[model samples]
Target: MIASRTHGGGRITVDQRADGSGEALQAIIGDVGDLSVQAAVGDFDLATLLTQVPAPLTALNLDACRMRFHRQLAASLLELETTAVGVKAAAFAYRQAEKGISEAFGGLLDAIGYATGRIIAISLPVIIPVAITIGVQVLVVSKILDVTGLDDVITTHFGIDLGKTKEQAKEALVTAVFEHSDVAGAVIEHVLPGIVVGFVGLPPALLDTDADHAYWPHDSQSMTVWLLAGANQFGLLLPSDVEVWEAEGVTPPHEKPPRDLEDLYLREAACHRGTDSGQVRIEEIVGPDGTTRYIVYVPATTDWSAKSGDNTTDMTTNVQGMAGNDTVMREMVRQAIADAGIDPNDEVMLVGYSQGGITAGSLAADPAFLADVNVTALMTVGSPISDFAIGSDIDVLSIEHEQDLVPDLDGNENPAADNWSTITVDYDPDELRKAPALRDKSDAEIADLFDSAGAAHSSTAYAASIALLLRSGNGSLDRFTAKNSGFFTGDLKKTRDYQGRRKHT
Candidate 1:
């Protein structure tokens, strides 16, 4: 017998028998054993996976979210297992062919069998592992999505480009990928793992943001929304409900609505001062055609203590504010309208920032609330109100920042419609400081201007951006502000404040 060394780290002794065929058979067996071991490793690797990808919602008791994360991890492991099976099957097929051919040709086939074994030994092991890795990546994200069932993960869709240039590029890329499905499929197979893990890098709360699915395409902010969130915070900390008494009517029905969005932004900013006392100033405007506009302002999150008893049910948590029934928010709004002595049939236009924006949207969308007061238009900044299904007739205006991330927490923007519109701001501290309102502030002060969602979510920053937008002649903004211009250019109107308390049942 001759001893032959194989790649499997074992030596196989073959009978010489004056035939070279045993050399090939020994080589083939070694390759087969090594392949088998590789397949085994793949099978066992499932247990070793670090399956702790965090969820979008940042709460300790979110069992549902944790389960979904586990499901994705499990699905990935199963894909790995399938790859292992394919490797094992390939090994089995090679071994069987070698056995049958050897039996048929006797020792004469040894040279041919050995050459075949060399090719298999050299090629398949390298090929199989690479192919499996590619396969796992290709299937992992989709597999996770498949098991996601209609749980409210605040998941975002891959479509929708808020930029004209990016939208054009996206169209071209999407068309090409879909046109060549095979190539696109192959590319996706390699990159899907990277896509899934990228969003898991930073939790939004650290930067005072909510979780967003895609950081680049989906996440953004708005100062208007932050201000509203700030208002909510104020209300919670005061532990009081909010009340809004209508502004006194303009003299000749043309004196209000501010000279420009900057004027409007300042007027809105001024509302922030009164939030500490839990009273917000609101404007009730009457137009030439008998249209009425009720301007409402909301602030940020406050009252984060155990004073509220349950975080999930409290108005202080964004999750509760957006997801749960609007007990505190709706009550404050309802009382505001009622205290202002506005009739149920009067048209209401709601505007707010952050949590305040959310509360406004919730009020606009809630049928019960609408039945009592007609919500005609809504304008929000930095608010995640996408889940609120407001009426189509209501004029909706939203502003967001690409890097803000808070607006993305609701998973999507409202569907495109003529009455619905958006303004997206990409905030810059230098640009913001240059604004007249912030010009006098030092760089450090400018840097520290906005707290929650960075400079983009800053009220002063948004005020500057709005001033710029107004100057740019954006049609939607022009129309919204121009129609309400009576507040700034026309007559004297009376503004009032109302007090509110939470209805703790």
Candidate 2:
């Protein structure tokens, strides 16, 4: 007989020698069985009996004994339904506990995943749109500014004072866009969003300005544009008022043409014929107090064949303003300064709009102009001076409005130093309504009619900024000054008093 104990607290007993032997052996078996029964009844303990065994146990024999005992115990347990029922109950409890644990862990993982997803969703919209908008603005400004070409122009012209140097201007622009909250807000709230909304409707009201009377007397130092021609086969050559009056079937007071066709032909001959006869007309206006002023208006003789369209020269001669005649105009300005009683060293204020803006910038670039006439400041509106090289001697303040693409001059050179400031004004629809002159027409109708033939490119809010630049000195005409007086006033819907108030207010 052999016996062994299992880890589950069960004991097994087996009979290995079961032969028909002496009656003594059978009697011994019977005696053992009686002892087992007594043990089961609590008269003896089986564990104490095993410790009391006198024989020595070998390793092999012990292992064989354990195997035989396990087999018998398994058979005995199978025979007892009560033991099987207990085993099944324990297994069921273990499986239920495992299921509970698995479900709890899965819920915790799901919670974590759900929380992570929420964070990503909340941040993505703000981050993606802002990053993309900034990238687009940078690319557009860089392409339009074209600092490389500006640097070349600066190096070619010895005069400084265009604004910040190209590198400095670029850094300043970048810093202004990023570090200045107002600028960023303007871009996000007004510029970029408006662009996304598209130009279908009237521009935002901020850019609109009241149109002043055509003959309004500005300050002595005011900026002005003196148109020299009427409508030609090329297009209307006068100011907006003249064009409007003409459209209404009103006859404008006729004036002598500023230049004769022969003069234009001669000027063109000088360019194409390689002659020095392409002389510009210089006019000196004497004020009532006997103060003499000079104006050098270039004749429309510059070859615009390159820009002429549908591939044919359009009725509008606007492209002529951009041609190589800029050099001739520059020389004419220098000569005009020399002809004036003032010394060439005298500081002068240069002001122009559209073609005149181009002329002013070109004149500022000449070393001769710089030496003979000290340009205290240069102001341009609707001028594409972005393509011209600016000189350090002149401080420039350029004001442009949305949808006015003419002033986005394609050939502006580089700014000299921090002396140049480019301001982009948003257009306002309501302000146009307030303008008594424009009240009869809707903004869309006005924009459509005026914007055609490229007139909108040269149009500005109310010419108040241009007027201020012309009248002021030291380059200190704040944008607020213009905002308060002109088209901006109506667009903002603010009281007239708000003009002088702090911008933050």
lDDT of 2 by residue, 1-505 (tens): 1111111101111111112122344455456556545644542356644654654465346546656765665555444434444445555666677668745543343333334444445667787899899999977766664655664465568655344575567755553443333333323222332232222222333122223212221110011111222122344331111010001111111122213212212222222122112223333333344443333333222233322222111212343334323333343445444544445543345555555566676667656556667665565655666545566545566655544545533412224245666655444434433444455777687666443333333332334223323333312234322321221122211110000000110
* Candidate 1, run of 10 with poorest lDDT: 1-10
Task: Report lDDT per candidate.
Answer: 0.53, 0.39
Q: What is candidate 1's lDDT per residue for 1-505, written digit by digit as tens? A: 1111111111121222212343454555556556655754654464433332343343334545556755765565556555555555556666677667734433222223334434554677787899999999867854664578422242335443324444677656654543343333222222221222233332222322233322321122232233334565654422333333443222123245656667655665554433432334566766565555566654444434524432212344354455434445556667767777778777666777766678788888888888888777777877777767778777777776544555665545455555667666655555655666667888677657843334555566678777666654566676666554544443325455543444344
| Model 2 clash number | 41
Badly placed stretches (over 4 Å) of model 1 are 1-256, 273-277, 288-293, 306-317, 450-453, 483-492, 503-505
Residue 115 in candidate 2, Cα distance off native in Å: 46
**Backbone clashes per model, in order?**
39, 41
Give candidate 2's error at residue 256 in angstroms: 24
